[model samples]
Target chain A: MNNPASKRKPYQRELPVDWWLKHAFYTKYMIREGTSIAITIYSCILAWGLLRLSQGPEAWQGWLDALQHPIAILFHIIALGLALYHTVTWFDLAPKAADIWLKGKKLDDKFIVIGHYAGFVLASLAALIIITL
Target chain B: MSHTDSTKLKRSHEPVFWGLFGAGGMLTAFLTPVMILITGILVPLAIISPEALSYERVHGFATSWYGAAILLVLIALPLWHTLHRIFHGLHDIGVKRGRDWQQVICYGAAFAVSVFVFTLLLQML
Candidate 1:
C-alpha cells in the first residue's frame, strides 16, 4: 500500500514567477516595502538626536549646525518625501487591512482611508500653527 | 467525495482570513496619526528646549518610569506593525516556502531592535 502522507498533494500548486508582479496589489506592496526602507533610514536622524544629547552641549550644537547646512537640508527633504509617501501608502492600505464592523455592517474602506488622511492633515496643520506661534 | 469536501472547506475559510487582515490594516491606519502627533510635538520640543536637548536632561527624563514606559511603547508598537506588514508583503510577492521561518525571523528582529533601542534609551537616562 502507498504511504498516505507521501501521496497527499502539496499545499500550493506551482505558478508563474511573474504572477505577483502582474497584480496591482503586488505593486502597492512593493511601494510600501520601499517606504519602509526610507522610514528605517529616517530613524537614524532621531538616533543622531539622541547621540548628540548624550554627548553634551558642544556635540548637540554641532549636530544642529550640521543640520543647517544645505546638503543636510536636502537630505532631510528627501527623507521627508519618503516619509510622506510612506504615510500616504500606509493610510491607503489601512482600510484594506482592517475591516471596521459596526453592528452587523462592515464600514467601507474608502471612508476609513479618507478619515485617516483628514486627521493627518488636520494634526499637521495644528502642529504647524503651534510651532509658529 | 474527499477532494470536493476539502475544497469546499478551504473556500469557506478564505473570506474570514481576508476580513481579519483587512481589519488589522484599518486599525493601523487610524492609529498612525496619534503617533505622528506625539513624535512631532516631542521632537520639536526636544530641539527647542536647551535643557531637553542635553544628554543629561533627556537622560533624566528617560530614566523616570514614565519616560521608560513611553519609550517602550513607542518603539515596540511601530516596529511590530511594520514587521507584520512586511511579512504579508513578502508572502504577496510569492515567497511562500518556509513562511513560518520567515515570520519568526521578522518578529525576532523586531524584538531585538526594540530591546536594543530601549536599552540605549535607558542607559542614557
Candidate 2:
C-alpha cells in the first residue's frame, strides 16, 4: 500500500552526510582530524627516539641518521603544519569552552584569543632565546 | 506579529548560544596566524639544531611548564570544540537520540587526555 506519509516530508529531516563537510565547522573539523593523525605518527617517531636513547649513544645517532633522510624531513614538515593548525584551533576554542566574566560583564572572545596568542608568542620567544644561547 | 509568531521568533533566536559559537569561531581565527608563525619558524630551526634531534632536548621542551601549558591548551580546546561541533553534526544527520552518549564520550575523552597529559607533566617536573 502506498502511504501518504512516505511522500510527505518528515517533521525532522536528517541532513545529508556531506552537509557537515560543506560548513566552516567541517573545515575546522577536517583540520583537527588531520592533526590528530599527524600527532599519532609524530608520537611514534618520538617513541622511537626514546627507545634509541635507551639503547646507547651509537643507537641514538643511528636514529638521528634515519631522521635526516629527505623523506623523514618531509614528513616532519607535514606533521609540523598539522600540529600548528591543531594548536591555533585549540586556542580559538578556549574562550568558547569557558566564558570569562568581569564585574558582571562577559569578555569578548577576540580578547581571549588575542591574549592566548600573545602569551604563546612571548613564551616561545623566551624559550628560543634560552635555547639559542 | 501574532503571539504565535512572536513565540516562534523568540525560540529561533537564542542570543547566548549564537554568541558563544560565534565568539569561539572568531577567537580561533585570530590565533591561527601566530600558531603558523611559531611552527613555521621553529620546525626549521629544530631540523638544523643538533640538540633538537636529541630525545632529551625534545622531551625537555615538551615537558617544560611552558611546553606543558601549550600542549594542554592546544589539545584541550580544539578537541572540546570539535566534539561540540561533532555533536551538532550528528544531530543534523538524524542521530538525535544519543546526544547524552556523545557528551559522555567527548567530555570523558577530554578529561582522560587532560589527566594523562598532566600526569606526564608532573612526572617530568
Candidate 3:
C-alpha cells in the first residue's frame, strides 16, 4: 500500500524582513503590536514587585528604590508613549467589537469610541486619586 | 461511514484565550498609562512623593482581599493581552519556526506569573 498524501507543495509569499518599514500603514500596525513588549515588561516589573512585597519590608523597599533609577525612569517614559499608542489603536477599533444599537438604528461608532475615551479618563483619575489618598 | 459520523461539534479553545485577551486589552488601555505615570514617572520623580508608594502603605493594601485582587489583576491580566500579541507579532516579523512552542511559551509565561502572584497574595493574606 502506497500513501500519496506526502506530495503536496504550498505556495508561500515572499515577505521581506523590512516589509513593515516600507509603508506608513504597515509601520503603524507593527508599532501598535510592538507596544506589547513594553506592556509585558511592565507586567514583569509589577510581578517582581509583588514578589518583593511578599518578602519583608526591606525587600519591598529595595524594589521601590530601584524604580528611582534613571534607566527605569527612561524605560517608563518610552513605555508610556507606546502604551498610549496602544490605547489609540485599540479605541479606534472598539466600535467593531461593540455593536450597540439604539432603537432600530445602530449606535454611532463615534459615540462608542468617545465613551471608551471618557471611561479611560475617569478610570485613570480614579486610580490616581485612590493611590494618592 | 456516513452513519458513523457524529453530529457533535469539536470545540475550539480559542474563545477562552480570546476572552482573556479582550479583557486584558481593555484593562491595559484604560489603566496602564496612569499606572506607569504614577509608579514609573511621577513617584520616582518625587513629584507625587515616594512616600505615596511607601512600603507600609503598599503592604497594607496587599493584605486586604480587594487590594490583593486589584494587584493580581493589574500585574497579571495584561500579560494575557501582551503575550498574545507578542506571539502573533513573532509571526508577523517572520518567525516561521516552532509555531506550537511559540504559543505554549507565550501563554505559559502569562499563566506562570499569574499563579506566582496569586500564591504570594494568598501567603500575604
Per-candidate TM vs. native?
Answer: 0.57, 0.51, 0.94
Where in model 1 is the C-alpha error above 4 Å?
A: A1-25, A58-78, A93-111, A126-133, B1-68, B92-101
Task: Report the C-alpha lDDT of model 3 over B1-125, residue by residue, as the tens digit.
Answer: 23434765678888999999999999999999999999999998888978899888999999999999999999999999999999999999999988889999999999999999999999999
Number of backbone collisions per candidate, in order?
11, 1, 0
Expressed as tens digits, the lDDT of each residue in A33-110 for candidate 3 is 999999999999999998998898899889988999999999999999999999999999999999898788999999
| Reference-based lDDT, residue A87, model 3 | 95
Worst 10 residues of 2 chain A by lDDT: A38-47
For each of the candidates, the C-alpha root-mean-square deviation to the true structure, in angstroms, is: 7.5, 9.1, 3.1
Task: Show pairs that collide, candidate 3.
Answer: none
Ranking by TM-score: 3, 1, 2
Better by lDDT, candidate 2 or 1: 1
- Give the Cα lDDT of each candidate: 0.59, 0.58, 0.94
The numbered model that scores best in lDDT is 3
Question: How would you class the docking of model 2?
Answer: incorrect
- B32-107 in candidate 2: lDDT tens per residue? 3333333334444453366644556646666678976765555444444444455565565566666779768755
- Between candidates 1 and 2, which one is better according to TM-score? 1
In candidate 2, which residue ranges exceed 4 Å CA deviation? A1-24, B1-47, B51-125
Estimate, for each residue in A89-109, the C-alpha lDDT of model 2 and write its tens digit: 778777887699999999989
Per-model DockQ against the true two-chain complex: 0.17, 0.11, 0.85
